[model samples]
Target: MAAQKNAGDKDTEEKKKEKVLRRPPEEEIIIRGGKGASIRRKEIGPESEVPSGTGKVAGGNAPANGEALAVHKEVAVKVDHLSMKFNLSQEKLDSLKEWFIKFLKRDIKYDEFWALKDINFTLYKGERLGILGLNGAGKSTLLKAIAGVYKPTEGSVYRKGVLAPLLELGAGFDMQYTARENIYLYGAVLGYSKEFIDSKFDEIIKFSELQKFIDVPLKNYSSGMKTRLGFAICTAVDPDILILDEVLSVGDAKFRKKSEKKITSMFSSDVTVLFVSHSLAQVRRICDKAMILDHGKLLAYGDVEEIADRYEEMTEK
Candidate 1:
């Protein structure tokens, strides 16, 4: 009986040792400042007792730990009441005698042309807003205003974040310079640091598929080739806000498809896109909302389908 009791005592001791060995060490989680308060922890099993120095498990109402990531933050771009106008003057300078005669007559003619009149819109992050209109509908002008290239004549334009504009195929490119040199120059003109351009150089070249001709001067490049390079460079540095003005039409069919895919990928990120296109079908496919402009005036702005239907109705009338 004593031998059996001794064996039972040994078994009890082993059970106590196993319980001690299975216990986890006390865990302390420290959250650094910068992001808002609230650190989350996973729940422990009910059978296990939490030790001192360990934080309490977060409740179900608490946000997930992934919510603290930077990508979860929201951003927006606002463009308020932007308008532009150009003044044209008609003045004739004649011979010395005629100039004196005209001075005596004191005649002058001036005309005011409004390019964009009281344009207003806001683009929240991750939104793809399409601007559609006819040839002289001020679509390009509105894009330039938003890009800060053209100051408004009457109203104000306010953008909340960084803006990347692809207004022209090669707006700042120097024909005399090599493609590599032009890349730096254009990047600088677009407000990118030299360091950024250097880092993105290889990616830009790869995307353009022009590594073979990157050493050649831009003047020697075909229009389509130049367009490809320009598009690649413009898109390499993802900006908070992106403006595109009829630039997608510059390349061939295949390149255009590639550009479209690139743009789609960008939209998937936190980028806000303001796109101007003459292709109504393409606009319908890519845009959740659309604005219709006619002769420097906003005819309609709302849901993509509703605006498109209204625009078609106006055109048919």
Candidate 2:
């Protein structure tokens, strides 16, 4: 019996030694190239200069001891109980003479219109949100509010870092100037310095593929050319937050494809985005989350794919 016990103990010792000879502490099994590869170093986080790992949902600030909490280091946008109000004239005057007479008498009447009411949402850094709604459903109003085009009638909006809004095609452009001159002018309007625009000049012109018409006056340029130029300049700067509102639908298919590629590339980067599009497929393809609004009211706000499903149901009825 003693000999049998000794043999069993020796067998256990050999197994322990074999275990120690296996994989080292420095090497970890990670899936790479469709197979597990031993990696020696920790993967970098999303906000890192060189991203090597997926982004963790950063937790909230100031947690009690032993308490688990979500805390992100930064917030791109926070909309708190926001509302937008506009007054539309109930009656139209026939001529300027009649309008002046009514204005002098203080008799112009309007109906109260609330484009947005008590809308609230928070956008985190490096998060992409898609806004879904039918026409006149206040999607544009919400985006415009965030873009600072329209002031909120109620609540407040807080934001950090530079905002690059592509709300309209050629909004700040000078039609009289040549496309080359307009590049600098529009860049300055977008808050870029002359030197900065100078540096991005070649890249912008190359992406727009408008080298031959660079010196042509912008007014003579077709809508597609204008859109291409505008898109190139806006995307040149790696903006902290980007707001796009149906801007891509204007250009031709090829230009649209190029624009889509640029946007998709930005999605991989650390850029917070607010996108409004009628295409549900595009929303699902790009957005991390989605929000649905109907007649100035928020219907649903959650995962992109789920929201797409709900939106389809809502619209079908």
Candidate 3:
């Protein structure tokens, strides 16, 4: 009887351990979306530790070590010690049985891919920050993290107001639905109300220039047409913060100019902008401040012209 009880206790303990191991991590809280969404509040904590050799800027614009950053201006966005990590499997198992066997045997290995590491920055209201990086430097990953599409592995991003993310335009559209149907569906996905969408419905259709084909299924619409519609819906209302990821050239040259004009018109307001563009000249034109990322780490951040010059040097190398 004593031996049986001990065995049962051991089994129960093992089951408890398994349950603990199988439990998922905490769900990441996504902030508000779309135009006029209220910002969520997070308790501000001490500044996060910066990685070694970071926080340097050209022209001596950055605050010195141990020097308090002068921040009298209202902050629009703050990214604190932000890090994004992914566990890439070392080997590909053919089936679920094989994967389970490997998992039970503790034979599965993973490669830790740090997409963004120890990134820190702050943007004031009405400032445009251009993000510059080579391919795979984690520019898009950083933007996604800020947009709350991907939860950070460490740290946090705080924003003051509504955010309109123009990343992966038309990503949420239903291919089987008509353009008219998708306008309402996609609008709700962005946190807009039916009443709000109803008011902007015609404007969105007019801007997309899909009047004749509004009743046609989205599956039949060309990729460019879908992109134009997505752009029109997202930009229908002015947002407090706008995140742009390689979306300047959405459709034909004419539509592209129209879209660019719409974005530029927002700058005259007090909205904060985070822009990522491969064109150095475009970044210089659209941003007053800039930052560069190399190998998932912040390399340089400061005045736009200096960073553009540095980016040119990096490209030449």
Candidate 4:
């Protein structure tokens, strides 16, 4: 009889054990479809662990030193002590001739610029992290590092899923080409195939609200016009990870709000967003977490409210 009682207790304990990041047996999986199929899941496991006092969390949920970091069974992006450096020449050499002459005499001089310094952070799947700093504060440099446009001088960044960066507006655009032609050109830069661009062509046109101006030469369009179209094209397709750098500031108030709505909708899916903006209000609205940087160093990293408060305090003083 005692043996039977012990077996019953063991069975109960075994039943209590569950899989990590899995819903309870009674919970149901929700699937939705439109452009693509999406599964709604209840976030379980160590993801709910609160951050440590300094914004770095420890314990079992914390990531290892160099592993494919998983904070709670899901990691969208991981940046490990990332840094970037550039060298600026002391003297201006207007032409190749001047540079060659300086090289022959061994008189080239440069000052090292550390654009970013030992910055470390992580973004879980479906998280929006806003980066805030004043001008010349390495905000854009950090975004460029994550986008793989500029190689890091030290440390590394690991990202899963397809990434779409709205870093430079119309980077590959041809001034002589028409708006319609530039779509194919910029689309290619964004990693979209010709067929995909063709299918989404009309959708992009309508969203930009530039149908009448679609066939006009890009050189003739105003800066705002170009911004509208570029924003429309980049946001048209859903990205697993999105990076935005000052792209929203060019548009008007109404258009900016429209773009915000589009970005806000991304939150419904498992999309990780990284952005740098001077507009603290916009960042606070779109991102739950914010990282404050000053002079190439991390000043604060925490909830948007905390970081924003810290930033305001610094700026005010």
Candidate 5:
């Protein structure tokens, strides 16, 4: 009996050793600087620069011991009881007259749909948070709410920095206008002055690789082209907080790689990022912390690796 117990203990020790061996090595983050364009590589540690306390829920759900609150050194984004309720029409009317008649008769009905419900979490300055979920999980809706594009039915979002949100492609562009004109228009929509846009105009175009088509109407551009232009313009501004929703996956493979590199370069500047992507591996690469949403409710939020593992399990099932 003693021999059997010793054998079981030996098996457990072997499994533990194997698990540690399977861990990947730490990666190096590249930092760029100077006119000479010198590059410096910093080893990324297992721990994040900013520690998200035990309260991984939205709105800083701190633990009773106050450990979570103590670790959150700087607050950048705070969501308080955030809930978005959309009144979806129960029936479709083919014509405006029909809708008006139904409305007048009090026959119209709407289904209350909550895209996000009492979501809570506090994001610290310089922390990258990856939001994970299946389709219709309200990831995009949460970003839109945080970006101030949608007003919540309950609670509020507090932000303490210049926010740059890249949500829908071609959102601020005028299809009738030229790409050059839309650059200015979209820049202005993002709260950049004409002078600021002027300074970054050439760089934006060069980065987008749209020099030849700059004068062409935006309506003539493809979805990927619009994504490139929007990404270039938004990233040029050096925003305090960057909001992204699946913009990285639209372009070709080469352009996608370039854009990923661009985003990686920005990490050294300590920009707070809220990213929603379908790629779990991408999330693990880009984010230190992550949150999981299901049916518009937050299920898990914490370290990226743990959340990614949990998300993978969910997808597999």
Candidate 6:
């Protein structure tokens, strides 16, 4: 009887151990497609320690491997320790007397917010890098920094080739001007020669599928039409380095498909692409490597599938 009791107790303990080792099924959530896939929230194992003297991250610290160094040899764009900060301010309403007093002192109250901090990465010719992060994670800020629209508060960016950023389409477009006139205006902003713009004018109009409205004022066109025209004109100029934000998501499905094909073709060519998108599937399809940013810091940078898995894990939280 004593032996039997001991055996039963051992069995119970073994069963408990087995249950503790088991993990629950991961829940799937679809963003924009077929059956939603479950987010993988598994902790990643440590990668092999790369040798020293390889490359560097933000703040001028060398990376574990020569990843950035190797890319710099082949590509023209190198971002090093890029950071941006914005000042937040609010007006204080005091008594009229207090306000007058403060006005005499010329004192102001404000708080500083870091929009991007210590962002470091490298891009090579013909490499497509995808940037993934939630809103306010500094996606747009990074692009603007690379485009030279916002100078980094810290660190520096190095560009070896001409960069054409499709950030804000029609950013320089004159609403009152006809598409023909805006073509010259927008083309010049993108670094195109007048002759080049003249040569590509018909092609741009044709690709936009807005030839019928090409002579009309840009303000007269619908939003979709405007987006199509803008995209066509911007992308028509062949660029060595292209930065694409979520702007491609503006057009209709047919136009979107066409734009996708155009982008794929560009990817196949020598053009280096820095793409920012929330669509993991699209990112996986186009990018060979991806980087995840959270609160202005890089969480991971590596193979697209691996990074995507890590990103999904993070979202599950």
Task: Give the candidate number with the greatest lDDT.
Answer: 3
Where model 6 places Cα greater than 4 Å from the true spot, the runs are 1-72, 92-103
Please, what are the lDDT tens digits per residue for candidate 3 over residues 181-202? 9988887888677777888889
Report how far off residue 245 is in candidate 4 (Å): 1.0
| Candidate 6 residue-wise lDDT, 227-297, digit = tens | 77788887885666788998767677898899888888887657878889988888988887788888888
Instruction: Give lDDT tens digits, candidate 5, residues 118-182.
Output: 88787777889999999999999999877776766777665545577888765678899999899
Model 3, which residues run further than 4 Å from truth?
A: 1-70
Where is model 5 poorest over a 10-residue stretch in terms of lDDT?
A: 24-33
Model 5 off-target regions past 4 Å? 1-72, 93-96
Pull out the clashing pairs in model 6: 55-63, 56-63
Better of 2 and 3 by TM-score: 3
Q: State TM-scores per candidate.
A: 0.71, 0.76, 0.79, 0.77, 0.77, 0.75
The models' CA-based lDDT, in order, is: 0.67, 0.71, 0.76, 0.71, 0.75, 0.68
Estimate the lDDT of model 5: 0.75
lDDT of 2 by residue, 1-317 (tens): 11112233555356445433221111111111112322212211222222221123212211223333213335566666778878998888879999999999999998999888787676667878899998998988888777666767776555554567887876668888998999988887776777778888999999999999999988898878888898998888777688999876778898888899898888776788899999888888888778888889877776677779989998899
Error of 5 at 9 (Å): 60
Cα RMSD for candidate 6?
21.7
After superposition, which runs of candidate 1 have C-alpha atoms over 4 Å from their true positions?
1-75, 91-106
Q: State the displacement of the C-alpha of residue 312, model 5, in Å, after optimal TM-score superposition.
A: 0.7
* Model 6: per-residue Cα lDDT at residue 156: 62
Who wins the TM-score comparison? 3
